[model samples]
Target: MNRNRRRGKKLSRALVTAAMLGDAGTARRLLRRGASPELPDAHGTTPLYAASVQGAADVVALLLAAGARPDTESGHGDEGTPLCAAACWGHAGTVRLLLAHGADPVLREDHGTGRAPLDWAERGPHPETALLLAAAVSSRPAAAP
Candidate 1:
């Protein structure tokens, strides 16, 4: 593989590991040490995306605070948003964190049946997640007349 591709793979692996471990401090340190938060894994999952899916609120927050793109899509066939992954997996805290960080609830996965985060929440096994998404969507300002 080319040098850039190899480096990208390495960074992706490190970020995914840090996220899965839920070690926000370690993730932040690695990011500061030049690990790309936006690097996508072989499965097209970014570190922030993985952290969100794994319900690592602090890691999600750290990645977001570090300027991770909230709307970045997984390059995988899923093409999902971090918010969608968080919602689908019943990660309420991660969902809330992503929302507070201005994640777009309207973002739709390209490969899936084009489901939004709200749709994922609705289909989740946890009713509370659906309720939270409903409340959040309702509370958002309606477009100006």
Candidate 2:
């Protein structure tokens, strides 16, 4: 990788690890050091996405509030989106936070799976997650549908 790209990867890796570990301070520091919250690692997972999958609500909020795209799609597997990951993992708080930040639970799916956050939530381990996402989807104006 080029010098700038290499540095960017390091930052991205640090941010993702911090988010996964729920180290908000480290995450903030990395972000301030010019880390791109949306930058994915070799595993194709961004900080916000990793935070969501790990159920690190604080880290998810931090990344989202810092302007991370709430709908960042993972580059892996039926891939889905951040909201999808959170929902599938039963991170109700992360799902709600992302929705509050304008994430679309209905975002397009990868691999033509045509799955949305609601779809993932339906299969989630927590029933409350499905309820939370259902309410969020219902809250959006019908015009947006």
**TM, every model:** 0.85, 0.88
lDDT of 2 by residue, 20-138 (tens): 89898999899889999888888887898889888898898888878888877876874567888888888888888888899886775684466888888787667998898878878
Per-model C-alpha lDDT, please?
Answer: 0.82, 0.84
Where is the poorest 10-residue window by lDDT in model 2?
A: 105-114
| lDDT tens per residue, model 1, 11-55 | 768887899788888898788877888877777778888898889
Candidate No. with top lDDT: 2
Query: Relative to the unseen true structure, what is the C-alpha lDDT of residue 29 in candidate 2, on a scale of 0 to 100?
Result: 92
Model 1: CA > 4 A from native: 1-5, 111-113
Clashing pairs in 1: none
Give stretches of model 2 more than 4 Å off. Answer: 143-145
In Å, residue 106's CA in model 2 sits off its true spot by: 1.7
Model 2: how far is 81 from its true place, Å? Answer: 0.8
